[model samples]
Target: MEQDLIVVGSGNAALCAAIAASEKGARVLVIEKAPEDMAGGNTKYTAGAMRFAYDGGEDLQDLLLDPKDERLPRTDFGAYTAQKFRDDLLYFNDGRPLSPEQDKLVGRSLETMKWLAGHDVKFEPIYARQSFEKDGRLVFWGGLTLAAEDEGVGLFEAERAALLRAGGRIEYGLAAQSLLVEDGRVRGVTARREDGSTVDLRAQGVILGCGGFESSRELRHDFMGEEWEAARVRGTPHNTGDGLLMALELGAARHGLYSGAHATPMDRHMKEYGNLDIPHGDRKNYRKICYFLGVMVNAEGKRFVDEGKDFRNYTYAQYGKAVLDQPGQFAWQLFDAKTEDLLYAEYRFHDAHYVQADTIEDLCAKLEGVDASAALDTVRAFNAAVDDDTPFDPTIKDGRQARGLTPPRSNWAQRLDTPPFRAYPVTGGITFTYGGLKVDDAGAVLRPDDSPIPGLFACGEIVGGVFFNGYPGGSGLTSGAVFGRQAGYGAAASLSPAT
Candidate 1:
């Protein structure tokens, strides 16, 4: 297959790259490892919220502190926080620093959100602080509503439709095996088809958006260490970080220092039975959120984050240490009668397939099951703190010092001495890796010295320049969209004249 632009993987970044390039009047082609009819990559299974910027109308302009593109509603948190992303990357290179250039990329992302939402990409702009909750004890019902697979997948299909309408080519059910670099430039790619045949694809430029290493156990073990096998893959199995490997071999660098990321049970199960656990017709109000919030524990039967905070931040980087310290790389979510009721209605409890016991003795029958002792102890300690004014200080570690938070988790523990205790057992490490090929604000891949890889562009998880250390809420896909467009537009601009 030959094209002006060849995009690897059908995930958010890959598809968005393809769309951006195609929209810029380039003949683009997107290849996937999955079957033609199957959901090929991770974006299909995402929460789909653009967390970069929100309009919030006229009164919310204060949030737009360091306005970059004038298109996205800028906020102090995003402006300063995103500008300071490089400080988080000290773990890799002490000398390398990212600053103002990143702000440019941030600006582009803001504009991308505005353009996409205006294009009818159904999204909810949320401007809440990021928080964490370990093992999801709070009974979260569904995921943040955004562009569903229908929209995400539809975006890809529409791009293909537009490309074909504009004379572009799309080859699915074919996996990219290697890059054909001649004269230090990406000219084409080697593809492996399902029928076990290899084809050499010629292209003017290539966009690597094949996604992170969620399905690649070898890559997982190499970067994330022990958390690899225990990591529950929330992405489409086809996105095993193949592009990252290809890019690395081609001298590309990684970003987003942390190799791991988050995938909720709601996200994991929904990939297959994922839809079943969501708020359906009659199953909506089976539990309350506060119940799930109260008893959630790490591998050690203790709360690690403020379950009361918004779900986006609470689940990302929080509680990962316990999984790294434990055997199964897993954690548990527990609750009781009244708690379950709160989860049902408030948290929108998904499925009934949880570890349930009518008595404390029965609940501790298994080690992986609910620990009656820990739950009992936690409830007792919390109740004592609440009634006796135990001067409880709520603080959590963010790979940094612990900051004091008012009203420690379970600040009002009412005691769990009653019957009908239940638990939801879920185990999955942070599967999203922030490292990949480095890119500039225009989403163009860069070298170690920060020079753009001419005729080469990248976005999403496949590129690392945007991700500093930890991720801000809505940043992953948001960054992907922002850079994806830039890469597409920027890559197209490189393909000028008689090429």
Candidate 2:
């Protein structure tokens, strides 16, 4: 195919790039490492929640597929201002200043969402997971309230359909091996087909959006640590650093925290690369993120982190690494019957693993790898410290605390004295690597000397430096859209007569 622009990968970022470039009259071709059914990178494995700044309910209502839904009247879609979004990103920056890429992400977030809506992608309130009904009104917390309809799969299908409608073409089962650079400028890529045939695809410009190296055990052991080698992959196994390696081989500068990643508390026995046989919605059941509703203990039967330090969205990404560092790379989350109704649906899934007992003593005894006696003592200490005067409320950070403990619970601290206590085993599941190729504001790959590489653009996980130690929840997809659009525009502009 004689294409004007080549987009590597077929995830949200790649599709957005292809669609945008096609809109600019560029003939775009997207190459995917996975077959068509397993395409869309880590996006298909997600719940499709997207975090962006909006003024209030009105702004959100404008983006919904059905603005006239009856529930919109009673739902409180609180404002998530641009300042709040910047604050959330800075909170996870590990004391570093926000980068230019992050600035673009924040500035362009809402417009990029609107842009997606303009492209026929639909969105709906994330009521099931992010909101709680209080006083006959649904209140959304954590500053994240919207998601693409039907979650990740829906988002992928919608974007893929839009790309096809825009006259963009996708070639499945073709893994890009290296950039086709001629005279120090990228021309296209050399890819290997699934049937072992090699093909040279030439184009005016190339945008690499494949993904990171979270699936590569060797890269994890080398860049992160030996402990990370044992961490289970939460997304596609095909993201084995192919894009990162290809970029580096061409002198692209490396950026971001290679040792850090977006890890989550997953079922201890989840299939190594995640189960593909199950339905898309069922796959998220493997994640156990309700630890905020209870307490987590390492193998030694002791509290390791302040479970209520913040909302799950702010803490869940880094907590998984904490779980990986625990003995046996596992921990158990214990909750009483009090919070049973408040737990996410993932906990109630049929395949969800847990041990339930009528008493704390019995529950501790059932913990597979923990010390029973010490666990009982720990539970008793935690129970004795909780302040019973404050009323429990799940809709907000009510400041109900467990005081005078070694690692005190700062909020939502309820004693596990109720009958039928339950414990769920969990371990760290890596979602994506934090390190990737450094790109400029236009999403053009930059050399170490900070010069843009001609005909080479990048977005998605392949373009890094937007995050450091951790990131706020739902920012990944938004980042991809924002930068992918930028890269597509930049690539198309490069093909102008003046260039």
Candidate 3:
């Protein structure tokens, strides 16, 4: 039997593609590698934050479910214009201008969010992670303010509900083996069933959205350097580069930084892979944020990257590589009593590796893998460099920088002299690789010669070149949705005359 579209992988991207194609009167069939419980790929383990350009509070109010509430006056959501979005994307790309592919993603981001909202995917302010309540009003810092109603799980369930409502079918536990190409055109795919049987699923178009090589230690050691082998998989174990390999086999040109990925500081003792047995709320707890509120020291008891060089959303992705390069491939984040109240929700997790002491000297003694004497000295020197004249503020970039310190803290520098120090052990948690298939603005997979591969389309993490060294937090899902919608429309329209 044949279908109009075969969507491989049941993540946000694949689901968006399936629903879009089905809405166009195309029969869409989805292939999911994992069982029903673990179906959403990396989308299942995210905070579901959606980053898009908004004019201001009034612009955001148009997209929210409850905009007229009395609390609107107290809250301030600064504008994130299209120019700002383009600038942020270019900043990570080393100040180069946005490519046509990137321009398409950024330009259509707001539209994608609106489209998802029309499908019943609710949006709300990210209070827990992106905002702070000051003087009885919530102020959303950073450019990110909106997220899916209930976070990652909620976004996935909403997409699934929308897909089913549009007459789409998802088959779980059928891992895609390879693409079926005939006469230099993709026709379908060969997938392996859970019972060890092979089936040829034919369709007019095929969309590969399975994701990156973060879960494969061998690939990590080969492409992203050797230290990444010890890094924990922050998402699904099934994303072992299957879709990437399948496209590469068909002459798809690879693009972007092969040695870089979106890695973040996570709990050192979290499970080897994302645990499906735990609740979605517990899944996000593995991340260790609020590092900008304190200082991070290597096992050698020396400061590395400037913890406050920028907002955590801008720096956290690349900082993981610095931690992986530390001695024993780990680091410790130390905080004083002053900033303790401002710590993120993840700091309160029961399983997080942490120690508390009444003084800096006692806290150094409790840091197991870190050198005691060196850590104490590091803290003292860092405290001495803080510019005391600049008042501390967590809501904005107060220029309270540390002067004359090696690897200086650029902002939010407060003396760690207040009693009762706390520390958390941390290692790199890789989310996805930056290297993947090159695609056009419409998500059509392209060849080395810049020609689109007929009948082949891609979206989500599988479509590369959008992100380079550093990633602005919450933009991944936005890119996935924007490109996923295009890929679905492109796939169905490519065969419209014949259908």
lDDT of 1 by residue, 360-442 (tens): 55664443644557755655555344333333222222121112323254343334556787665544434366656777756
lDDT of 1 at 44: 47
Which runs of model 3 end up more than 4 angstroms from their true locations? 68-70, 496-498
State the local distance difference test value for candidate 2.
Answer: 0.90
Q: Can you give the TM-score per candidate against the true fold?
A: 0.73, 0.98, 0.97
Local distance difference test, per candidate?
0.54, 0.90, 0.87
Judge candidate 1 against the unseen true structure and give its global Cα lDDT, from 0 to 1.
Answer: 0.54
lDDT per residue (tens digit) for residues 1-499 in model 3: 3588899999898898888888788889999989999999999898889899888887776567576767678888988999988888887887656866678877898888888888887788887788888788888988999888678988999999999999999999999999999888899999999999999998888999888889999988988788999999889999999999999999999987788899999898898788767788878888887889888998888889899988899998888777898999899999988887788768987677799999899999999898989999999999889999998877888889989988878899988888788999999889888888888866789999999999999999888788887788988999889888988888888775767
Q: Clashes per prediction?
A: 28, 0, 0
Off by over 4 Å in 2: 496-499
Per-residue CA lDDT of model 2 for 1-499, tens digit only, reads 5788899999889888888889888999999989999999988988999999998988876679888888888899899999999999999998888888888999999999999999999899988889999999999999899889888889999999999999999989999998998988899999999999999999888999898999999999999999998898988888899988888888889988888899999999888897667888988889999998898998999999899988899988898999999999999999999899999888998999999999898999999999989989999999899999998887788899999987879899999988889999999999988889888877889989999989899999877888777788999999889989999888888895733
Give the top-scoring candidate (TM-score): 2
Best by lDDT: 2
C-alpha lDDT (0 to 100) for residue 176 of candidate 1: 91
